[model samples]
Target chain A: MIDESRRVSMDIHYEISQHYFKEATYLQNWKLREWLSEMVDEEILYWMPIEENRLVKDRRPEPTPDDAAVYNDRYKHLKQRVEQIYTGQVWVEDPRSKIRYYVSNIEAFHTDVENEFAIRCNVLVLRHRRDTQIYQHSFLKEDLLRKTKAGFKVVRRKLTIDARSVQDKNLFFFM
Target chain B: MSDKDVAFISGAVRMYRERRGWYRSVCNVFMVGEKSRMEMRVMINVKELVDLENATQAKKIFWDQDIYDQEQERIFGRSWLFLTHDSLIPKNGDFVMSRMGEDKVIVSRQKDGSVEAFINSCSHRGNQVCHADSGNAKAFTCNYHGWVFGQNGDLVDVPLDTLCYHDNLKKAELGLRKVRVESYKGLIFGNMDPDAISLEEYLGDMCWFLDTILVGAGGGMELMGPPLRSVLDCNWKVPAENFVGDGYHVGWTHAAALQILGGPLAGLAGNRADMPYDDLGKQFTTRHGHGFGAINDAVTSIHPENEEYADFMAETRGVVAENLGTPREELYMSHWNCTIFPNCSFLYGTNTFKIWHPIGPGKIEVWTYTLVHKDLDIDVKRSIQRQAIRTFGTAGTLESDDGENMSTCTDSNRGFVTRKGRMNSTMGINREGRHPDFPGIVGASFIGETSYRGFYRFWAEIMDAPDWEAIKVQNDNWDEIWRGSEFWSDK
Candidate 1:
């Protein structure tokens, strides 16, 4: 009962979601450099912006990426971050936070660029560290994925958390 | 008289009053109020709390609830607290929510280019009137009961003006409490006490140092906000003292970070034994407790990855020297860890401005913003902002490296045995003196506690004095505390 075009599109969506799952696993396992090399494009942008509580009377979009952010990085900077974490010296993550990412609500759309699709999802990241309460962070994530020869590679990821202010002691764990 | 002699006389006076039963009579007549009674019982014993002679602070100061209450009343209630920068609310009616100590404040830019600030609590009921962080607004309406306050914090509208009260309510008198506000080079600060000194005077000799960064590079600085905010479970003073002068921790605490990043400070990584400790940098503290530790030629050192920022600073260094003099010219490119008394701190090179707003004795809400030169090219400003956040923002590597220590430093004081202990800050005690070119006491090395001693000295001075008038009496004698040694005479 399934047409070939519809089946192929559904398959691509499933493949993208699967790719995301693998990427999350890599991050959770503290295999950051491996994830960067195997799953991300050479020209990737990873950004996590600070959210502000705005009044309804002064409605405005969230701050731009160019504005201050928690993590705003290009491929080179992201690699540097991986190196910093792996140095066994960044005291913040000497014993890294145990983090699990619950990625859901996946939606995909084709971009004008070749073999590229814009994927949107909602994620809930639960992080536990150093005998403290488990920090719950709910965020909306948007990823630009390219259909490379080896499957899908993330070209951009923008994460916007729900709260105006972060409650976590540190964002040592990637969401 | 010696400080100890004055203390002895005061103790004798107290004993005499107690022996004659006059103390109780005086309490009955003058301190009948519950608040005054509580204050009297928990009055800060300056001599016991801070031993300037030993450069050791009683750990109780970090965990005692009573001392924290007095600080809220005497220190934060009277200090010039940083509110917001002119760039944050440049236009008329633009407002930002900030805190002065534990009290929430709303700072607004008026139509006339002047700024105004007010307590965010509603006059009718104790509800927060403004919840938004920063925005342009004609008025703020209380969500609880719909009492509207204008941009200037005047009561503009009441939900039931005529029908409910029949003009019985004095709307004119039911306005938000106005906070005294002033600006220095585009940085706005608010004070609850009207009798407090002007912002410039409060800053004092620190201005000569601040101008090197704030007024450098063609124009002054601007803060990039909606700041990154996070709560730190630590006593406010822990971070304040750290930022005031904690360079000793940098090469040790952030050794791994600096080494992996391979910046100018990378040489200090892992406490490298061969590193020249004394020649690294110097520290200075002013009369009002404002202080900084300067690491020579390390400005833009944290941003090794940002070429544009490095180039921008390299270009601006000459102009800054021309504008601020050679002494400051040298400081123009030096990295600085500084604190402006009570709770504002910023790293001049790191460019992370922080306000440690105390929630209680054991907790502080850290609000951080990136500081940038206003006149720099937009790209350059953005680059600096990015690099600053990457290294020192709310989730920054260096910031995270410090959070655990700050929290543990305060939380451990809850132990009765721990609270009774003393914390030492005697590094470079007799090794600091007046700088020939710079104002205030200058230490021989950056990694020293000269500023810590000065900070607590002023803190005790303020807490012990009954009023500003009483404090002024000791103005001429302030520097005498460190007069025994003239260590920096040759410099």
Candidate 2:
């Protein structure tokens, strides 16, 4: 028989994993603004690839006192980008509209502090546009998850693409 | 044999020469006029190009086959094409695949620590010798015919040579053709011409500009690879010209991106008049056609939110000033949209280096690498690479926008009639001249077409000159076209 303490620990772990999984799904689904406001801390460091030794970093914009307005503004910008697919606002996405994303191979590791876990996963995205042409692309993402009072949230995320040349029509789909 | 008859003959010859010159000039003007109409009526000719002096209007140069073939011989063959950075092949036997025009070439570091490059095709059957993009190997063996070649381009052995030829075939004569290779600081370049000018002399005053980013702050730059490669259906010169000095596009083309990022450059999104347009920055074109459009005091435009990055640039500014002097020091702190003539471009402050590897008149395989200071911390390096990929890589936000424009520009010039018409690049025509502090002719603003003119001037020289010897006669006359002007003296 499972003890009460053990049951509680298992419940917490499951809850954290479920939340983290959902957050990752949201990000892959092009819901960054929602995910950002929901999980990310005030100061989140986003590291991206430059060529040689260079790195391009983007920190989350500071939140305003009018939280709804700020969230709405951010959401509108994201929506505009998403809406670009139909309106030709973003040319990269107009020609290629079909995308198939496979998010799997999830592994969770404990961080230095208790109640904090790091999640690493492999994502294989196959995109097709105009017709039935297969274009395979993949990326590896590492996420830091902290157990919050509301369950779990992402603290930081690092993404590394496999291909040296980004072999795609354009970067329309979020990785 | 009378003196009068002698004078008449001389006069007749002079008249004949003058008439020939006039006829050529008229034909050029007519071609330019026809090209301009073509740009408006149909797709501009992507490949067919006329003489620059004949081109009264800016003509699309991206889709012409004859022009592409000419470029392969006149420009790519003779010019010192950038191969790879030395950091990529630090150890002996290290090799990387690079492109010259449409041809593939392998650049390898020899056992003697010297670098060499050769056409990637096998000599026997014209099959590609090295299949992998990069690796460390003492020798490369052809997969098709089983021929082996040393790293320095010597034919080491062949499987059936002795058996088929009975020791009669010449092994030394079958080696791969070697290209002339040279490097400035850590950047390597390859040339196909045996009689081409030395790389340093070819680079000319552009070296001074290069030193600002290459050797500034007592810190040298290194390229982070493997490169991010992508194909864009556009004329290679479009991007080359854009990066060389078209800062005008940033505030307009990337308005949405800038609005979303909301940094130092966000104010440029709505075309705000109070954004200090006049004093924003200056544009420069060099003798060798290297040029840049800079945005003053906004080096970290892409990442204004990163305090650590801003601090790093600030810390390095003092060192750059001490090493390269004040003018270049100012350049170090500014965001530069720049291009090295023929087809290498980069954002100096943004730290993204790119080579618009031309595939044909209308197609280009863009190879992008992140540029960084060698002395920076590992974490910082990783961060820079990540951001570079995010913003400029194949899927980069900014890269995607530019790709569509490049493709449209190249594709629209496919019509025959369209190819004949000229497009306008006459912006700041009578306004640009020499300045006391700047090297090349200084245009009035960063958005002007002065550098474009400079590029076309060199392009014409290479296209028309029969040989290197022919090109030598125009070396001293380079500045003659811009003389007798004082437009930039006060500025």
Candidate 3:
């Protein structure tokens, strides 16, 4: 607990949080292509898995990355989704819903991997669609950021939502 | 009322629900123990609700609680409902939670590789004995009070049984309610009715059509699961009928996505005036409500971007032709939208399988699985899974387009006045008949509602029939309802 060497300094914390803030803006503005190009590595694994409440004996805290997910995507597929959304024809997103992502409780830690840091943050996503309940859910996301010539790029991102089953109509946006 | 009178009253409730939009408030009013009085108000003639001859269906069927209730008891209780696939629970003690109509059931693979299913509710207190969506379990122990049931739904143990009950407890008699289980080509189905016909008999001629897709390239298909489940506000029948034979919507509803994606189906975008409407494909319906519309040479339409999948299909067509026949070989190279009676549907080209589990009159839980040939390369299977998820998964592009329409179809009928209207399914009714090569009544065009007539024809039959015996009595005369001049007779 008292390892000062491992603890990230306030300067580094600000840097990481600021980068996260910018990414959130791109998503909120529906500039997903721009966000992906600027912040994500070409070989990144962006995943958000479905959660099930199983019995204690069958419970595993972390399901493998290869397990079934709502979104287990790579660069090409993600780019297609982004392009489709921009077409103003994907009905679910044509009249895009208003989404605001609150990314906070940021923590940055130094990992043993070379030039890589783990960023854990609590993201509260508030989404509003036509004449429906405001879908608000909190999820914890862990992203591994690697230092690049252009500041940083997410090499891996894993999101675990805190809901038994998704009740919303559609998840048309990235979390 | 007498038992017969109660049954008739229940049927009357369904007729009223189909003739007048019976929303939740209407259900709440009658659910307050005034069913006898409500039955008097809802004594509608069933013949008027579904005019099979005229191909008109009352709108109330979509959002009426009474009709939903009747469907659960009569249709679901009697029909062979899809439970789970063999690949999903392959090993002993492996179980997956599934639904039979509204009732929750657990499908478990026993040690002998035979499958068994039982209601998920505990016999003691009606609490769900198994809460997990899926997992391997030696036995499911009830979390509420520690009542343990074995893999085959046999009650194995009870805490304080001897001391609390003085050994009077009959554990054997208190097992979870069992269902009649059967499998056809690795697909397991369950029925609550002991007197219902067997699964093979229930599928009837639909099997000939199903064989083209389910059994392919020498190995059968497998469902890639833990299925993506999500709730939507829509009547279960809306999607069921759409999948059965609503090819008309594809060119318009998903026009934008199709154009943007740009595949073999892109010409359908914007409902282009000059598109090949007549030569698109064919539709079929069998003795059961099972039906499908197929488009020739567009098997991989949505994923036109995928070349490897196309190569796999091209390489395997000859083997399929050898194994099944030329008729099936033609089917193998086509895109299809199919529905198996009550609520299982899949697309052959799109390769997305779905179960629309009705939660209420106006809501359903959609469980989606990607279907793939078992013998394909793992990479090809993965690619198909990816494309399937992209097109029809919970948040898929094409799926979302239909979601809004399905919801509106149900909710808009909430007005009592709106339920009095009729929804037309008379698109190609007069142009379909028995085909020489195909087993069911075939339509000339894919973009027609011929299958809708067949779907509702059986829906009304099951809704009115008391048991499988009654269904069998009318089986010989089933095609008599579709009395069109045989269009395919010359072909």
User: Which tens-of-lDDT digit does each residue in B1-491 have in candidate 1?
Assistant: 99897777667655653554555456556765765636464445667889989999999888788888888888999989999998999899999999998899999988898898999999988899988888998898998999999999999999888999887888889889999999888888998888888899889888888888778866878888879988777899999999999989997788767877787799988888898889988999988888989999998888887787777788888888787888888988889999999999999878899999999998888899988778778887888888788878766777878988898889887797898999999999989987688899999899899999999989988876656655655666788877877787765
TM-score of 1: 0.92
Give lDDT per model, in order.
0.84, 0.71, 0.84
DockQ of each: 0.65, 0.15, 0.51
Kindly list the per-residue Cα lDDT of model 3 for residues B1-491, writing each as its tens digit.
58697667567755654546455356656675756643533343456778888999999999888788778778888889999899999889999999998999999999998899999999999999988988999898898899999999999999998899778989999989998999989889999999998899999998888888778787878888878888888999999999999999998888777877787888888788997787889999999899999999999888877788888889999999999999899999999999998999999889899999989899998888888888888877877787788778765768878887898899988798999898899988778888888888898899999899899989988886656766775666798975656788776
TM-score of chain A of each: 0.88, 0.58, 0.90
**Any idea how many clashes model 1 has?**
0
Model 3 bad stretches (over 4 Å): A1-7, A59-65, A112-115, A147-151, B1-44
True contacts kept of each: 0.69, 0.22, 0.44
For all candidates, the clash counts are 0, 40, 0
- On DockQ, the candidate that comes out on top is 1
DockQ of prediction 1 = 0.65
Worst 10 residues of 3 chain B by lDDT: B37-46
Cα deviation at B151, candidate 2, in Å, is: 1.4
DockQ ranking from best to worst?
1, 3, 2
State model 3's lDDT: 0.84
Shift in Å, residue B23, candidate 1 = 4.6
Q: Choose 1 or 3, whichever is better by DockQ.
A: 1
